[model samples]
Target: MAVQDLLRQRFFPHMWCPGCGHGTVLNSLLRAVLELGLSKNEIVMTSGIGCSARISGYVDFHSLHTLHGRALAFATGVKLSKPELTLLVPMGDGDALAIGGNHFIHAARRNIDITAIVMNNRIYGMTGGQFSPLSGIGVKATTAPYSTIDNNFDVVELATAAGATFVARSTTYHARECTELIKKAILHKGFSVVEILSQCPTHFGRKNREGDAGQMLENYKKITAKRGSKALEENPGLIGRGIFVEKEKPEYCQEYEKTIALAMKGAGR
Candidate 1:
């Protein structure tokens, strides 16, 4: 647990640019929140406005730094005002799918328990490059300087069709399989989306020349080994990274605690 005492070194100089895969996704998300021992006041780390929302100002614990794409609506009001906080929502890709695409599809269709680490890096590296919504459908940024002819929003198939129980995709040159798919999307209960695939390499590596940072981690290790053997020969169809989705619904704080116990037992007093 000595990872510089779980970082927040007074926000020590991390604005994320040097061949930035958002600092290998903030060092595999502080080693998957210190290997899930949790507690640093139970973790919050929300974010928004670009450069991966400056990683909630270097993460000491209980961060916000909001309002670019509204960081899953301020991480759904800090997990519905502390429903046992562990809500780590790091964003990017134009602050989560182009101006927070309807708050990332209504916080994954209200399955919002929140793990959402989406450093997609497909352009728009802090308001200069532009063209995001995942940016791969042709690619050339600075408002698609002759390439991106639309069509590119596959953020784990739009967070498993916006009902996100758990969704995965990893990159940043596989930083330990993107920290074990963000440590199984923080012990999955409900809304969990990973979708990292980072590496801007200074505005998508000088517009696809893709040179330094070891040739963009050797073209992301040959595009994640040909997209991980075509997602194991397309088993269950088109699943790209590991753990494409895991189910078990009923989360948004256990269905908002059963609708506040049926509105306090129908106000019987």
Candidate 2:
């Protein structure tokens, strides 16, 4: 359960930039996995192309570093083939909500048994400061010199509407809460989503004038509140945190097995 034991020593000195929240999130994740008493062999991590996605490479576990925005697709396939292995998918803001939008919704709709952790840094940190679907309206990006006018996604709401059985939200500033929520999501039966608002000091931070990672995290603490808390009621702009939804549902792979059973019985083979 020690954190160091979960790391791939040869790949030490991660590639994340200084002040990047990705490192913090990764540590929180390892903590959660360790606390859950899960062995590295029992978990399979998958990721799409982005800074956050790089986490899949650092962990000493079965992992798939898939193409951009296709992590869920690969994760789903892996789950179907090997239902016993726990699927842990980590994706970036744009990687999860923009290019992977289709896969995101479909995965939720199917109610597949996989735990997806989205490290939402607002802007596309890995590929320049491009506006991501989770980036707030009026934010500046390389693609939007003046400001990005597109409406941002409320990830928790989106996941709930898409039919994920369990949904939770937390910020990198709230590392303890984030790790706990991740643990809960992983243990949930059906599709689960845990959104972590990470700070990208390299791209989003510079573009938004959020100062360094420390300053950005301080802002996050001031702007976010637990779901249904008095702070949210007092401050309309405060983002809501905590689990939004948790419900039991028949999982996709289980349903597929039933269908296969019926087919075999009908064929009398």
Candidate 3:
């Protein structure tokens, strides 16, 4: 079914304010799900606290609105229990990187059967504009009235090093591109993480001179264009907006099946 038809329109009123990048990410997610032709009943959207968490409420699917910074853990449980449904987590930067940082790493290391889409606005938008772990060093934020002193985490690099089977990054302005990346992640066999660089115009933008949603959108275009061009020169096969990681690996579920089979054989079940 098309995503528009599957949308829970009743929740539209709760959508983020105009020019909010979360909306773009949300649209991309829905498009990806629809393109996969997966039934809404078979997909579960899990989320943590922050503006991004509200996504779970709007999607027409089995949804779990988890506590702050623990969406991945919750997603892991849901995936393990069902093992058949698609588990997708939509989390904000601080929610996934700060409070839930440990769980994120372990989940990646285990190659859990789930996909996480972190909306990296680079700041905490839900509760004032606090600098997030992904915030560029010396970048001005509400909490960092002067400049962000902490070094930011390159989320894709971190996830790849932690053992995520699929790790990629995209920004909100690349709507079609972001959607394509998300679809690839969803179809991946093991743990996948798509770091979405979003913009919180209400907080991050208003605080800085990023104008508003419109301005931030333009910035995304510029950045993506420059990066894409450079990548092409470095690696001709590097599509501007395509899967960066795609390799066959031992999925966690497949290994678990082997474990159960061996245990049952040993016990003569």
Cα TM-score per model? 0.37, 0.97, 0.92
What ranking emerges by TM-score with the best candidate at the front? Answer: 2, 3, 1
Clashing pairs in 2: none
Which is superior by TM-score, 1 or 3? Answer: 3
Candidate 3 on 1-269: residue-level lDDT in tens?
56677678887766587778888898899999888898988998889899999999999899999899889988988887789999999999999989999999999988987989989898888788888998877788878999887998878788888899998888888888898899989988998999888988888888887897888888876555423467566766432444556666788777887888888885843
Residue 4, candidate 3: Cα error in Å is 2.8
Off by over 4 Å in 2: 266-269
Could you give candidate 1's per-residue lDDT for residues 140-237 as a string of tens digits? 87777888877888887788887888888878887998898899899888789888888887878888778877688777766554345754565544
Candidate 3, residue 197: how far the Cα is off, in Å: 1.2
Pick by lDDT: 1 or 3, better one: 3
| Residues 1-269, model 2: lDDT tens digits | 58989999798899999989989999999999999999889999999998889999999999999999999999999999999999999999889989999999999999999999989899888778889888878899999999988999989999999999999999999999989999999999889999999999888889889999999999999989998899999998888999999999999999999998888885854
Output the number of the lDDT-best candidate.
Answer: 2
Number of the candidate with higher lDDT, 2 or 3 = 2
> Least lDDT summed over 10 consecutive residues: which range in candidate 2?
260-269
Report the alpha-carbon TM-score of model 2 versus the true structure: 0.97
lDDT of 2 at 207: 83
